[model samples]
Target: MQCRIISIGNELLIGDTVNTNASWLGNVLTEVGIDVTHIYTIGDDLATMKDILSEALSATDLIITTGGLGPTHDDITKRAVTELFDCELVLEDSVLDFIKKVFKKRNIPFSKSNYHQAEVPDCCEVLFNTHGTAPGMWFDRGSVKLAVLPGVPHEMKHLVNEKVIPKVRAINGDTEFRRSHYITTAGIGESTLSDEVVGSLVDVLPEHVSVAYLPSPQGTRIRISAYGSSDDEIDERIAPVRDHIKQKAEKYIIGEGKDLNLAKAVGDLLVEHEMLISVAESCTGGYLANAITDVPGSSRYLMGGLVAYANQVKENQLGVSTDDLNSHGAVSKPVALQMAKGVAKQLGADIGVSTTGIAGPSGGTEEKPVGTVWIGFWNQDEHFAIKAHFTNDRQINKERSGAVALEMVRRSIMGIKEMPYGFKKYPA
Candidate 1:
């Protein structure tokens, strides 16, 4: 089914609040085999809400709106919907009773403003909101279905999962829908990966299955969507193509779907293999260690880390040679390798990861300009260093360095020999 999402709030338009509702709803609809064609964000103005709703109903099979459902006067979603459907606002006694009981249990005074929350369009079906006071409303206009949900994330999620989705499924009945699987890849540029996939695999993929490349600063994700077939049929059709793509991009492919964080992926690999890791960070300032330990049960694998920001700390803590630092600078590959191997040996860990660089708005030279990062990983036998020259903002450069360090750890754990470009091996 085709769907359109409308997020209603003046705060969203003014950047006072994030419109996370649209992203969440779009993902939910897509999971249920519905195609979200457009997303509209409108201020709390009644005319804008009405116009967007009218346009959405005419164009899409399902119209979902979020926000502006509170008891305040500026909350005009229900009023606009009622006007559009030619219905009158009726106070629901049951909802009012629930609200009163909730307030009574909490020992709080229930005001007249709270009563306005129970007022709904007379023609629409009320969907109970167990988490909050605002109730969801569902209206059927000809062949199109419209659902109005509260802006609160928790309340909207509960209503959609418990009530809205079941109703949508019942309406959809036995209509066939497509299913897609996402494979996330990193360490390769989007244009390069796209060129390779389109040139090689386009002709081999079946008519029922297709691939789409989604790019962000982190990496590119490949989504394999299958249409007009049963689940088993779709799997059968896409399995070979999926396998072929995996073979083509095996080195770059990290994890599946939204499961592609480098730290988490590497941590899982370490846990599976039963290994411990330590870190020594410079320019990244313990970001690599923080990312690794952010995953639950990371204590099992992540021993600890040190942020050796000053050159003296690097010499004292990680044992980086002062002579080396003075000769080749702190961001050099030799210093990176020494930092990695020294930390692993000192902490008695199976692996050590390190990052040293100038993630800079300043502190750059003519040869080594801003965003010069050297990531290092050390196993028992040897150390490896990768030099990355990123041109993004400082925060993004740090993030990229952390991700690449974790990827190096993953590669080491998997016994992958060759490192990517800008990486070199050093003897133990």
Candidate 2:
């Protein structure tokens, strides 16, 4: 089965709103073994809406539309859909009563325009949406099934999961399902990880398996996707490719599963080792600490953090040496080392991590230029710092630095000598 998603809104076209709905629908549809062939993001124009609807009905097995289902003047999706189906708009008392009850619960006065929300095309089955004001509708036009849903993300997701997926599941019973397994890696560039590290997949991939490298600011995820009738068959198909990539990139592979991340991996290791960790950040501010604390049960391992953005804060709070700040500057190796050790002592933590850098579009010098970062680590047995060069973008630099810091902690806990990104670790 194939699906087409039509997004109707001027805000999306004008870049005011993101077209996340289409992407979400695409992923969900694909997981159910339905191929999402086309995504049409148009404005709230009646003519274009009617044309796209007509085209999708003729071209695809399923059609889902989002947006333009409001009470405003520009909300013309329902009208266009009704006109195309040659049906009259009839009021559904159940839907109207629900809307009225919701409004009364919120202590809001009901208006005439809201009455339009309860009216549905005579040719469609009302897919009741309890999450929002607009009720979703389903129409079976010959071969194609059209599910018109609200543009609100939560409402759309609710309707799809509650009402639409069951129908799709019934129609696609016992058929092949599309699924993916993700191997997440941090502190590695996409090009280097793909071209040199993972190498070619020509011989490793099975008959129906494929690999894709998804890179972001924090890390890279290698997706091993396959099609099979059951989970066991898909697992068998992807195992060879997954094992091969793991073998090739063993040290860099942080964890598996689609939602695996550096912070969660680090938190797990910290828990296993029964160690408490503290963070002292300079250029990255509280980003490193926030990432760590984002994981659940992090309180067991994460002691605390300090955002020592100012030189005085670095000295007075983290106890970075006054001499080093004057001589080597804040973004130097000595300061990084001292900051890491100082934070550990200050918080009485078993381990301390620090990031000091010039993350910039500016604030660079001849010797210490932009994107120059020094990440430090300190424990009872060992203390060292790793220097890395990153991008010109400030946000990217921050994300990469935080990721590298987490990866460094992970490697050290696992007793892996190899440094993240193969950078030389400088001893204090």
Which one is best on TM-score? 2
C-alpha TM-score for every candidate: 0.90, 0.96
What are the runs in model 2 whose C-alpha is more than 4 Å off?
Answer: none
TM-score of 1: 0.90
lDDT of 1 by residue, 1-428 (tens): 89999998999999999988899888888767788999999999999999899998888899889899897889989889888889899999999999999999999998888999999999999998879999999888879999999999999999999988898889877665677788887667777887764346756788868888897655678888877536787788778778887888888888885555667778788889999999999988878888887788899998888898999988998889999999999999889988998888889899988889999989888889999988888886666787888864888888888877776777777777766433666543
lDDT score, candidate 1: 0.84
lDDT of 2 by residue, 33-124 (tens): 99999999999888899988888888899999998889889988899988998999999999999999999999999999999999999989
Candidate 2, residue 368: Cα displacement in angstroms equals 1.8
Score candidate 2 by TM-score against the native: 0.96
Best by lDDT: 2
